[model samples]
Target: MTTDYNQIANQYKKAKEQPWRTRTELYSMMNLIGDLTGKSVIDVACGEGWLTRELRKAGASEVVGVDISEEMIELARRQEAREPLGIEYRVEDARATESAQQFDISVSNWLLVYAHDREELGVMCRGLANRIKPGGRFVTLITNPALYTWQSHPPDYRKYGIEAQLPESAYEGAPVALTVHLEDQSIVIENYYMPIDAHESALRDAGFRDVAFHNMTLAPDPQVGDEGDYWDHWLKYPFFIMIDGIKA
Candidate 1:
């Protein structure tokens, strides 16, 4: 199933306001990133430039946001026009992006799952790795491949208002739909279900070293989005996993 994100760009932006995205995934992704102070960063598949703006605020000396959808890039450019963060948004697919200088750090959030196959996944990984200079790092958060075997049992992260259980017919790398329940609405997004092993192999083929996975972690902050105790149940079952390593 080809997901034309351009059709759902607005909905995707709205979905980001949900706790699962604003709090859980964002916190975990940024945490795995450690620090961006004085780093040159690239936000791949940067829909609407949300992270591009935040990257500059996070202290990246230079930032670039890239997405394939012209509509997505246009929205990002609109944000740049309003605040003028000096960030650049290019409408090139990650597999085909280029620059004179590779970035010191590249961050992609919940993006790679869009790849339709292992070959495409390898292309994205290679492209992202090639964009990083020596001593640089690349990090991303993607749906946990463990869910592929969830033919019946579902992850116990309902408290966080998110859930995904593969049906009897679903297989790893197959298209899957996830419903994000926000305070005011519920939206579903399509993502290809690639297993973690496939991701690891792709990264390795792309020349990323020390590829490691970390479960989502909750910040101690009591007041973030809604239920303060939501993470208690959410922590037991990680819906997503963080993968990061040094660029080779």
Candidate 2:
């Protein structure tokens, strides 16, 4: 049940070579968080800092990108050196991140679903809430449980029940690994497929106010029309969800 940051780092390092959806997803997340001009942001589960770099480019004054993977941090550092922007990358667990620094906005893309359960997810949400200034925002992008339930392979209704779908894959070839949670040991991480209502309820329980959910459709970049048709269909029936709220 240990969170293998190394495995995640390795996966993300090879992510850039994949198709355009990766970039499209990141862009979609950025859009959900809105303009970043002159704001201090914390990117939780930041992976190799791709989104952090994008945030800087979008005019965020400062960004702290934190991930659980040391190897990912190393790669992120290396990438940052090539295009020096005022972004800082750190290897830290999302559930236990403790920094004196507060932020204007806290964002987690594809992170919440990986938490062990509602308890662990709530802990992370509360931690992020504590790290933001009043009136600041917390925005997250997660795999839509409904979409996973509808499209997952084998259509195994027993494990996940007919009401929910278990995530078996993240991309075309990448098989999603199964994880088991242990109370005293490091919990194996996997997506917690919950409906949108459950997600909003959990966020509210974590002390966030005014929770809202959005269905984001990734638009095909006119520049990459047919090459990005898969993304077009994806957007039409997006497999992801965007949620945002403010700290009370």
Candidate 3:
């Protein structure tokens, strides 16, 4: 099953305040991680660190945040002892994280869909390209493997509060679930379903390169309204998928 997330750590941190997670997965992973000032991030599966404290408030001179879930790194070390953005949480295991110092950017929003196949998605894409360095970069979000061709009807994401299910056929690892919807309760989370060419052949066999795959953006001043057409069915169909790469 492997979906313990430490007993739904605070219901997945209050379901990340679902609003399509900031209008679309943290605005398409911070606009593909444009700037981080001095850069040096890690954040793989960083559950309770809230984007690893927004990558050190986006000035990332350095930041860390792993998560094999020790109660979600103890609520990201209790919000870093209440509020001291020096981030550094860790419970480890983004496929056995082993950072010796090699970051410039290596986020992992959904943590490679929790790889259950394709050789554990190439050991989670070589542990997200061994924490990046060569050209540094790796942003992620994964899960839209064509969403299993929308098995029949499927498109109703509970008004973005979230909901997934899937699995009447599609296979490669299968097991989907998801479900967030938290206002009082509802946190599922159990992912797996890889095959966008097995995530671009597990990120070019773990060395990464220009790989790309994004589609979900909306927040150019969108607090949500009919003005944005209420995110037009989540911008057509994006349940999630934003992978980028570089690290070679």
Which candidate wins on lDDT?
3
lDDT of 3 at 117: 92
* TM-score to native of every candidate shown: 0.89, 0.78, 0.33
Q: Which stretches of candidate 1 lie over 4 Å from their true place?
A: 97-99, 149-152, 156-165, 182-186, 222-228
lDDT of the candidates, in the order given: 0.79, 0.68, 0.83
Model 3 TM-score is: 0.33
Encode model 3's per-residue lDDT on 114-192: one tens digit a residue: 8889998898889778889998888888878777786434578787788788877778888898888888878788898
Candidate achieving the largest TM-score: 1
The predicted structure with the larger TM-score, 1 or 2, is: 1
Q: Give the lowest summed-lDDT range of ten residues in model 1.
A: 148-157
Query: Over 4 Å off in model 3, which ranges?
Result: 1-28, 31-37, 41-101, 108-116, 132-139, 145-168, 173-192, 195-232, 235-238, 241-248
Cα TM-score of candidate 2: 0.78
- Residue-by-residue lDDT tens digits, candidate 2, 1-248: 34466865655455444343344467667778888898999898888887778888888998999988888889889988998897899878777746688899988887877655566667777777777888899998886655544444433322211122244543321223433222222223345555566667667876789998887745445676576333455555555678899988
The TM-score between candidate 1 and the true structure equals 0.89
Assess the local accuracy of residue 62 in candidate 1 as a C-alpha lDDT between 0 and 100.
96
Using lDDT as the measure, what is the rank order of every candidate, best first? 3, 1, 2
Shift of residue 186 alpha carbon in model 3, Å: 38
- For candidate 1, the lDDT comes to 0.79
RMSD of each: 2.5, 7.7, 16.6
